[model samples]
Target: MKSLRTLRQAAAIVPIAMGRGKGRSRQALAERLGPLRGASTKVAQLLSARDGEDAGRALEPLPLARLLPVMRAAAPTLLGDGATIGAQGRRASLGQVHRAELSDGRDAAVKVLLPGVESDLRSDLGLMGWVGRRAGRRLRQRFDGVAVDDWIAALGDELLAELDYRAEAEAQGRYGRAVSSLPHAVVPAVIVAGDEVLISTWEGGSALADAVAWEPDKRAQLGEALTGAILHPMLTDGLVHGDLHPGNVAFREDRGGEIVLYDFGATREISLPARQAWRALLRGEVPAWDALLTLGFDAERLAPLRDRLDALAALLFAPFRERNATQIDGAERRARADALLGEHRMVPRLAAPTSAIPMIRTLSGLFTILGHLAAPMELWRVFDGADAPAPALPTRAPGKHVAPALPARLLVRSFGEDGRGVEIRLPFETLPDLEDLLPDSAREPIERSGVDLGALAREAFARGPIPQTLFDDVVEGRRVELRVIEA
Candidate 1:
């Protein structure tokens, strides 16, 4: 067993200082340890060494022994008597999740902060503020006409606010209620306590791989449901889930085809403009050229971004795009993302920007999972439609066994210029069937429906025209297709 002293020491080495560029520092720290054989072992030794006086001094406001008592007191309120505490897992940017049980005698989850975490967070924010000011001065040339200080300050404030479990609990409740009307979606109930501890219900479901292997159509359905329940709130409601990765979502059998969302510590409220950008991208309404320009991304980098976004879109829409629903597995999807990010040195870039970490992590995980499921591009139709309601789970019909049709030809067309078109395809067979896709609850009216493919195609063409000569040929027998003319 790892000693508490060692854990404390290891935690101390984490360098809680703000604005020091967490990405860069972590890399440098990793490199520094390379020359030392068994570096981790040595670090563990130092951490475990019993130096109670020193540890207490370093810990300052909070002591280690006090942690268990604090946790015990808070656990009952959050988890109730049915809850049993488990070993602490790794600490994340927000808090740690421990396996537990509910008062009602069901398995559950609990989140608690490290001793003095609140105070440490406050100090970290102050440091970040100072660092942000300095960085703003140095990067003035690069970020001309932008409010660097304000951006940095906002980031620090965001970090501080995130440390508050109470705030997160409130946000979770608000978001949960917003999507409560939608079926096939689950947001765990938030258990509130004084400022530090949080407890929530835990839902059990199969892994993505298992789901896809069992049913492809259901996998696609899950994708659509997730976008509406989670993504919609983030894009239209100005309340970002902040963490939309697969780990944060679980598949439960009892809920029918609904997804169970876990972890709410990193939830952030976005602005109207950010939401607009999100909506435009999801609908394929934002032209590639415009997206690059708006985000201030370099044109040279557009190819990679376009490729990734297209692939991700297809994955998100797997059910509607791919006929068989079979594609690459989770491992392959991860490898593809890793390769792409590696080629672009995205990891290094990710490390340099602290504020972008959550966003990048979320995007990376989301894209990877989508790719694994081989989701289709058509689901974007659902994402972009402001008024579309969630789809109603079809009632089981007598002897019902209808095979899904191949994706519409028009929906498969590329978005690029004449001759050089980007193919949009999703791997559908790799995902779980529709029956296993969503969590079951009393059926609710579909808050949103599928996308209007015809309107979407027209909009895509309007943003970036294909050659007029190629238009008639592509549009033949298709409800929507690229209309291009030869020069």
Candidate 2:
């Protein structure tokens, strides 16, 4: 039975089993749960799907034939008794998408979650979350200065949200309003929806990635459209389309070929100040230090490293500086990336303002679309509003002292004999007391010398309020296998 307790139990066991060397236990449990509705079957389905492998070999996709029955039973109950199925098609993801047309001739796309998918996803995410935390901890150990949990949790949230069409409808509305000013862009309008079923106006366009074979000028136009539709929104408005991989975007040559954007599930928005700081930083200026400080940096940590932060900022933004539009070959970009990573290991904390995590994902996702098109556009030029030409890298040495970017959530997950011993969650706003972030079990070891918690926070955080260093030590300082999760 699908009870709250069952879901919670799955959530509890999965990560704990993963944290310990209980891979066998996790795998066995996943297997045992296979017969249950929406059980662990989806774990391998998503994995293989993303990897571009034979995903059906891992988990069978519901063929168009089988989709109708599931849709038939669920649609009337979900949409209404008057709803009728008009059209059906296979969505790119592992489910059938049906067009529900009413007697009134209104049409919409309805996606019903495959049987047992929600439960399967929960288990998969729990185990996958453990792996992500482990990876984050390992990366931290190497001083790579990245938090894996932040991205992973964001990812989990996005995937789960996709199951709810109502959320997607709201996001589509938000995106439509956000980019309403862009010339010749189309965002589908959502008509109505239940938890799993969405009814919206159908959208049609050529896949943006499919346009790679188009003429250079046409592809370039599409690239610019992609930028206006996807990139500029983040910089100017902070609202963003998080999943911009090739398939999610398209172009239409029919009506003057407007860039068509869809799949509004994985959406994110950055703060205004963070966006402003990014613009300043990309323009080869000192990123708005005040904005950076507002993000939560202590003056003490920032004072010693401002110049280096700028230097590192220069290196990170180097790739975007080349605005030739067509001059960059893949090899050269790779070389520059390698050189920067080799000569100076730029800290991740210094790369962007902390609140820009969504922006960070959006920017990286843009390049991924570019790589698919092999149509790398002059993104940097957009910032300068220039036409003559731009340099390959910053004309000056880089400098910027970035305090460790504060996490959205601070999680101290216990890795005791229970594996799921206990956790302390400190949202950024409530982190007034560093001691409060730890379990009673952790305070004794942390306050060993009666070190002033606030002073240590000021020294380590030098930004706003998190002493992630102290938190990191609490998780890592122990020789045991404790895991620290950055919220």
Whose TM-score is greatest here?
Answer: 2
Q: Which residue runs does candidate 1 get wrong by more than 4 Å? A: 1-67, 75-94, 99-108, 116-161, 209-213, 292-360, 375-378, 387-487
TM-scores for all candidates? 0.49, 0.60
lDDT of 1 by residue, 1-487 (tens): 2244334433334452224446455434333322221223222212222111011112222223355466667765545454566654423344556667565676666666765555454444443334444444545443421234323333444455666788788888878886776787888787654567777766566655455564666677776676667666765576767655545666654456777776666676654544554455444454433432333232333444555655554443343334455455656655665665555534233212223335444554555556555554334444445534322221111111212333332112222212222222211221122123212210011112233333434433442321111111122222222222111
What are the lDDT scores of the predictions, listed in order? 0.46, 0.51
Count residue pairs with overlapping backbones in model 2.
26
TM-score of 2: 0.60
For model 1, the local distance difference test gives 0.46
Best by lDDT: 2
lDDT tens readout by residue for model 2, 76-170 = 55445676764445444424466666545676666666656665556555655544555456455654333344444445555666677677778
